[model samples]
Target: MAVATQTMTDEQRKSVALEYLKAFDNAGTTSTGGSILDLFAEDAQVMFPKWGLATGKKEIGQLFTDIGGTLTSIQHHYSEFTWIFSGSDLVVAEGTSHGEHRDGPWRAGVPEWGAGRWCDVFEIRDFLIQRCFIYLDPDYAGRDTARYPWLSQD
Candidate 1:
C-alpha cells in the first residue's frame, strides 16, 4: 500500500481536513461516490452511528449509497475541532457536528427533519482518511429543536 512518507505542517494538515469536509459536504445531495471516497485511503474504515462499521472502499462506498437513498439533504457543520498530529503519517481530529438533516428519521412513521449533534473522530494517514468513527443520537433529528433549551431560545 502507498504510505505517506513525510510530515505535513499544521497548515497542510488543516487544509487536508478541510478538503475532506468539503468532499463530505458535496456528497450530501448527490451520488458523487468517487468524490466522497477519494479522500480516504484504499483500506479505510468508517464506524458510522446508525450504519455500523464499513471497511475498505467498496464497503464504504456502499454505505454512502445506502444512506444517500434515505436523505434528501444533509450537512456536517463542525462546531469545534481538536487536531493532534503524530508525525506526518497520522492525524487525529475530534469534533462535534452540529449539522442539519432533511428527509430524515430515515424510516417510515418518523419525524422528517433533524438538526443536532454528532461527535466525530477522524484518523488521517498520509493525508488521507484512515478511519472515521462517529457517535450521535440517532433520534435527535426527529425532535423539535425548541424542546432543547440549549439549541433554541424557546
Candidate 2:
C-alpha cells in the first residue's frame, strides 16, 4: 500500500501566504473573521525578530501577544509587496508597512532605514503554514539611533 501525497500549485501556495498576511493585517479586527492561528498547522512554527522562535500554536500565540501589545496599528503595503515562489512549499514576501508603535509611528521610505520594511519566509502545505520566519527591524520608533552616530540628529 502507498500513502497519498499532497501537492499544491504555486498559486495555491501564494494564496495561503497572502491570506496569512491579510489575517495579520486584520488582527484584532472582525475583517478576517478568524484567528490568525487558523491558517497554521497544529505544530506550526513562527519566528520573529527579537521575539525569537515559537513552535506550536500556544507559543505562537504568546509571541504574537507580546508583539501585538507593543503596536498601536500596523498595515502592510499589499500593492508594494514582492512575492517569490520556490515551486515548492517555500514562499517569500517582501514588503513595506506603516504603523504606530507604543513609542511612535513609522512609515516606509520616511527615514529609509528606521523601520517599516520587512521580509517573511513561509512554508505552506495542505493550505496551512508550517513555518514562518519574519525578518525586520523591531525599532519602529527609531529610538536606537544612539548606537549609530551615522544617523542624522535632525
Estimate the TM-score of every prediction.
0.64, 0.92
lDDT of 2: 0.86
Tens-place lDDT per residue, model 1, 59-138, is 99898787655555445545566667665445566544433445343332233234344455666657777787766565
- Candidate 2: tens digits of C-alpha lDDT, residues 43-132: 899999999999998999899899999988899899999999997789999999998999999998888878999999998888888999
Model 1 poorest 10 in a row by lDDT: 103-112
Among the numbered candidates, top TM-score falls to 2
- Please list the residue runs of candidate 2 whose C-alpha ends up more than 4 Å from where it truly belongs after superposition: 1-5, 28-32, 152-154
Among the numbered candidates, top lDDT falls to 2
* Model 1 stretches astray by more than 4 angstroms: 1-3, 28-34, 78-115, 143-154
